[model samples]
Target: MPAPCHRTPSIKMVRGDITEQSVDAIVNAANSSLLGGGGVDGAIHRKGGSAVLAECRALRAAHYGRGLPTGQAVATTAGRLPARWVIHTVGPVHSRTEDRSTLLAACHTNSLRVADSLGAATVAFPAISTGIFHWPITDAAPIAIAAVLDTPTSVQEVRFVLFDDAAYEVFTQTWREWKQ
Candidate 1:
């Protein structure tokens, strides 16, 4: 028999690229510019094609100046992925001078908020700042899990799609412990 889904607040850890995960929505770790950049951003843009950029440009024009606040998310069509919506979430960069806990929480909270707002039953997330943003993988693992655990939403399934072995291991280990 398949394992039952864990009931307590816990994140489902899976090994794969976030861009390819099939879910109602996928969270993109976007820069403040929202123009798309390296790492997960580039992969999503490349897979979703120019249409994603066009939609982002339109959003940028409409929501000018404010950009997107950390922990808050905005939605756009998936363009090419299996998912129908792309939730853009801005995660904090690990600059030594910046306090990123709140922003990290925001990343988790806002993504869930957007998904719940759209009535998505399932969502996929990438390790937000563990890439180019320099957030340590070990440190980020729990924060991501905590955010997902804290979100109050109709979302029934959440997948943490990790791009590499180290990240995958961290999420898996943390999730296993959290589940137990």
Candidate 2:
């Protein structure tokens, strides 16, 4: 493990559903299409309702017609969700042939920037890219923690919402080691 990363803001790790978090903003590990897909992306869109999708459509028509790029983050209304905003970011698929760690880190940093732009004080995030994207939790967790810690933002509370015991355990261990 690397040396502990010290951050000014408060970070919390919990095992829960990202969509249920009552924060100012929630991050969606969305596909590049910006349209709903499986896993976290699909759940968020399903739970947040049509208002969220409506804003997404507007974003697509105005700016992201070609789909959101990997590592870039965008904001949309939270709609019926407990949050005021949804920060959508596309995670890079893990590949043994190329180094894409920078893209993974950008997902967190860019999401935080978008959340800060919306004046969101509290933000919740899922274990991005660890799912169908195939990024190993061992590598992804540290990148996630470092990215959120290193980013300069107005966000006060950063909550990592891990979906399962394995994911939660990895994040918990990483968080402890990173804070050491």
Cα RMSD to the true fold for all candidates: 4.7, 4.7
**Using TM-score as the measure, which candidate wins?**
2
lDDT of 1 by residue, 1-180 (tens): 223232433357788888888889999998877778899988998898888889999998898456777667898888998898999988888978877888888888888878777877789999998888899988898888887887666678889999889999998998777778
lDDT score, candidate 1, position 100: 80
Q: What value does the lDDT take at residue 163 in candidate 2?
A: 93
lDDT of each: 0.84, 0.92
The weakest ten consecutive residues by lDDT in model 2 span: 1-10
Off by over 4 Å in 1: 1-10
TM-score of each: 0.91, 0.95
